[model samples]
Target: MAEKRTDRALDRTELIKQTTLELAQELGFTKLSIEAVAARAGVGKHTIYRRWPSKGALFLDALLPADAQALDIPNTGDIEADLRTQTYAAVDLLGRPPFGPLYQALLGEAQHDPSVAAALNERFIGPQAQRVRARLKLAQRQGQVAPELDLDLAFAILSGPLYFQFLIAQEIVTHGYIDRVFSALFAGMRPSP
Candidate 1:
């Protein structure tokens, strides 16, 4: 009996997350509401509230995968190749429908909502940044990156232009632009002779 109850609860939670994703795709994040999610999922508002404190939190949970490797930078024995591979993958993720638009909407909302901002940073941005920094540190030790380079600054330099094009310019991140950014960044990051 207890096993059945646990299965039911897990099923309900999955339902809630799937319903939230569907609604976010249809309505976008700005218009997504907890009430609507609960109604759509056929659960009480309190059920969702028990699971997630805010719409942003719930949306974020629904948006990202539990598999951390989805965003991990591969060690290909070449730092530039690895970075480019990861950047291309990231651009592909942000360029697709539902994912791209919904993520963009949440990013826009985070600008004005501290809770949302904190949640985004805590769950998504911070973890991703940490992974990038770790990859850079590995490259530094491998003699691919300059030993004296600041990992945090290196991360910002690599990601900043992509974010500018992604969020500010609201333009699709082209392969050409990505190549240019890497070319310039690698020029500076390469170990001195």
Candidate 2:
């Protein structure tokens, strides 16, 4: 039956995801290969290729837990609180295994593989950023943010430091960092009386 086939397909998909995660945990992202994933999943290489164009598309993304995907970021009444929540969530996403190393590898790989770069931009950064963008839009609507506020700059200002600390400076993003960053940006965003 079609339903049976669908169920079976879903099962295989999950199996592959779990296998990939386990393998990445054991192998780390640099040593992980698509051929290994296929072998471990007990599926043909083409099965994965059919779903994702490259290891860049499948390997890192398959292992990301659903919440870490930023698919449904909450928009609580307080935009400041929501931004803080999402910033912490983003930190959590990058700090985790598989996602962290894979992201690092992809950044290196992307220099040579344009497809990998596109996948990273499309699947990873752009999607996660939408949550923050949505929060900014809401703030604009609620008048917490100045009407003329540049949302992109606002987003970058708010998030860039956290990422810089984590990804570039390789420093800890303490809770104090979040509070200070938000308080400063919020001051800049509030409309002039």
Q: How does each model score on lDDT?
A: 0.88, 0.75
Candidate 1 off by > 4 Å = none
lDDT of 2: 0.75
- TM-scores of all candidate predictions against the true structure: 0.92, 0.78
| Per-residue accuracy of model 2 over 120-154 as CA lDDT, tens digit each | 66766777677677788888889888889988888
The TM-score of predicted model 2 comes to 0.78
Worst 10 residues of 1 by lDDT: 63-72
Model 1 lDDT per residue over 39-73, tens place = 98899999999988888778777877455445778
Winning model by TM-score: 1
